[model samples]
Target: MIQKSFCAIFLFVLGLGPISLTAQSLEIDADLRARFEYRHGFNNLFPDNADPAAFVNQRSRLNFNYTTEKLQLFIAVQDVSIWGDTRQILAVDGNDSFSLFEAWGQIQMNENWYMKLGRQVLTYDDERIFGGLDWAMQGRFHDAALLKYRKDGFMMDLGGAYSQETDRNDGNDFRIQGFFTYKALQYAYLKKSWEKSSASFLFLNTGFQDFDVNDVADGVSYRHTTGTYFKFPIKIINVTGSLYYQFGKANATTDLAAYQMSLEATYKKNKVLYGLGLELLSGTDQDGAAKNNSFFPLYGTNHKFNGFMDYFYVGNHANTVGLNDFYAKMVFTTGEKSTVLVKGHYFTANAALTGDADAYLGTEMDLVYTQALMKNVNLNVGYSHMFASESMSLIKGGRPHDNTNNWGWIQLIINPNIFKADLGTPSN
Candidate 1:
């Protein structure tokens, strides 16, 4: 089966020869990455294990690209596996399998028009709300089609996707989205030298299986988001601020109307950088009962938010107790080849109307350092410590005797440019 699949892929590439020849261009590029990670006190979050432990994981990826005058193609595959003692405890399916990460094709209709089809990563505005989540071992992807139009400082996007509905035995699901943005730095910010400032609006509509087995109704979900960001230089300091608002509804019994908002400020000077942020989620106490608030983390990448030991999202516990995060961060560069980062966060549990008015609190501290070993090699080490309040600990099923949780990891990356040949820039 593997051999057959390989042959099919090769044939598809060779079939493009006619177009490549007419364009009088041929270019190919590839990238390979490997990483190893170790974690301590990783299993304490699970109910079965409260003791500290250690484990290792290895991951690898390969990417291919082909470009012509009016068309482009890309594909990537990844494999992740456990190593040493970790394999014994976290046995995965199919003996460390490999899967397709991305497979997409783009066609340029004109200088300002393009269309893309197949699986790809969708990222916008610092990857806060719509992101690729590239930091994780297994990145996120969407199987969809996208169309984009650009002219001067104006842009527009439209996309849609469908997935197999697990709740419904019929295997039917649906998704649709539309987005628009306008950017003008010179007019909006009055700063001609600064990068562009822009505002975006997105509308999403999705359908899912009904909860009741016999119900004829199809669950429909809707979401709307608006966001903006600006960059300006004051004296020797470069500053930026970003904000977002999301309103949406789902089939869950909880209030369908939920919202999230956040504000971030950062300053950079010389080799030092500092940042501060605040995020809040509104509480919903409808039906005179405990109402759960929706927390989307739209403006903040949940994957990058390491507080709570990454237990909520990683363990699928985010639906339970709500989260409100406050954070501060700093970074310093050493010479030109190394840098260090430190961050701290405070978390509080939101109150549901009928439930406890005051829930819990937690704190997290993180430290990381990165060094360039060579032109193509780099190393990173990180440590994190989490302290949960009594309220949080109890709800999380943690024993009162347990005061804290800790985790650490080390990684190495090597990327070398194997081939580079320009096939002349194509004119669309």
Candidate 2:
């Protein structure tokens, strides 16, 4: 399988080399990353008699980019897998983790306007509302159409998408099970940048397929999120903040009302950078109103916001008692090629806990060291420890909080450019 993967990369370069030489420009690149992790209690409290889990996962990708005077095309293919998931001498890959990450094209309408369509990524300011979730192995992509405008320091983007189970002509029901996705989506983003500051606004609407009690598709339930993000410098400290509100129906029968707010400040002194931040996500009480009040980050990179241990909002914690996170961070530049980062997070429930339990969830500490091994190559090592309170155990299925909870990981990332060329212009 490894040899076959290499052969595929080789063939891609060979097949596109001649055609690229006659076009305006073409570039090919590859991204490879492998990570090993040891988790005793990674995302939850450690069970008393459970053993630790350890594994290695990898992501391999190849990207091709072609550019002309008025058009740009990009395609990315990726494979994500866990080591030893497939048999050594197998003829077929049982894991079946290969996929198309992105394939999109943009056509220039004029000097400052363009249209982009196909499977692409939407990453906006601070990524609090809409983001390209790159921390996960599969990342995130959308099949959508976009109208973009950029001029001076102002930018605006309008995007929309509709999803279906297949090309069936009979019905419009999206019945693919086990995957949580939107049936229809629309969003608008606007931004303005100054010399030292920037501000952006986003309005997003998402529609989910609503089903009746008989397991039949009934209609679509819609949710709306609107927010603004700002970043500016205050003397020696840099400040960043975001405010967002969510409304509309959560499903066929539930009404939604939620909000999220965050603020952070950072300053650099000598070889160290110090930072502090707070994030508040509204939540529904244990026995509160019937409406859904829990806030969800939707498509954003939740890992980047919460603790790295993924205690909240990685895959779970949605529609639950939301989060209140207070964090502090410090980064030390040890040398020209290496750096160390240490961060601490204190967590609590935004709503009342069951049985009048304590609201304090726990505290977590994360340490990471990164070294530049070579050009386009880097090494990262990290360790995290969670000090869980009794409240945490209550929320995590009554697991004992006295068990030691920690996690460790190491990763290597390599991104290499394979080819680049510019062939003056296209011939008519």
Candidate 3:
């Protein structure tokens, strides 16, 4: 019923056509991605008593978009299925459900003002520090409304949203956020000379309960995050840096404060690209007694982080164990239709330890080949290897230990420009 109401409202608005008949536009686009993987030693990362077959899973995503002069909308639906004898582990019941990833509308009031409301993504500057966190099998979203103003190189935004625990519940948890951005400077480096430097600030306040009903009874929790990023070109290298600080209260008991920083340098020339990155995070333990000096990736895409195996910062676990990651990657194109990419990751634990203990250490390597099968169809094959350290394997109790694991994946991406209607078509 809610979905139907939303669609009806959307179509009604879309039916309004363009605000200005002289200057109107329409566009439709979509992206479809699928992944197949094979695993070895994958069970090493899970509990020892757990079945190895449970680690293998295949996934796919279908993303669609439609836009006009005054409004824009997008949706991404995902599906995951198990292959071979791993069927039971990947249950196909309620667990397999379609989701509304991004369903939003944009109202462009004028050249310098607009508003977007609904389930949408909010990404700013370099996603390295503040992003939509879109790397997971299912990305993240907030039921929110956003107002934006833009002119020249300056932009400002205000947003708010609510999430209810019950269908007919009266008390609905909510969140509010505000952001501002400005391009401080823009210049040329050498040769063609192209450069852009900008700064952004974001403030978010949220009050919500945990997934389990028993977690927070009455009190509301909140988290405050502030971040900034700077980017420019020096010689042939592009440099970027990011920093973030978060403080809040969760469960009405524990007080939380954390921060993270990252630095990156990239060099691109011709069809070759190479880059290096470093990231650090600081947080606290569940007891709020010991300080956990880990890495908080925020909304950045984790797959684009330290390693492809995605052991740390996968969620909040890295918040427990301190993490120090050094990453590097290179991409090169072949002919006009094929491309090759290579990435390497090195990770080590930075947690404050009492005794002489080996921190977790790991390395990952990825190789990818891409071929443009057609104008809107592309095929990619990828393989990744993860080598774990002693700290990742050893176990203290009878439970299975965290060990090194190896996994590989193959994917296909289809992006088609399905339709393009004149901006004034509706107005006419």
Please count the clashing residue pairs in each candidate, in the order shown.
0, 0, 6
Model 2, residue 160: displacement in angstroms? Answer: 0.7
TM-score of 3: 0.76
Residue-level lDDT of model 3, residues 313-403, one tens digit each, is: 5553544655677888899988699999898877666554334447656677878898999898878787777776556543222223344
Each candidate: RMSD: 6.6, 2.4, 7.1
**Model 3: runs farther than 4 Å from truth?**
1-26, 41-68, 73-96, 129-137, 167-169, 172-195, 210-216, 269-271, 283-295, 316-318, 394-404, 422-428
Pairs in clash, predicted candidate 3 = 24-423, 25-423, 48-400, 281-294, 281-295, 392-402
Q: Model 1: what TM-score?
A: 0.79
Q: Ten-residue segment with the worst summed lDDT in candidate 3? A: 182-191
Tens digits of per-residue lDDT, candidate 1, 64-125, equal 56677778887766665555523454434456456788899999899988898888887765
Q: lDDT of each structure?
A: 0.57, 0.88, 0.59
lDDT of 3 at 255: 65
> Clashes in model 1: which pairs?
none
lDDT of 3: 0.59
TM-score, each model? 0.79, 0.95, 0.76
Evaluation by lDDT, superior candidate among 2 and 3 = 2
Comparing 1 with 3 on lDDT, the higher-scoring candidate is 3
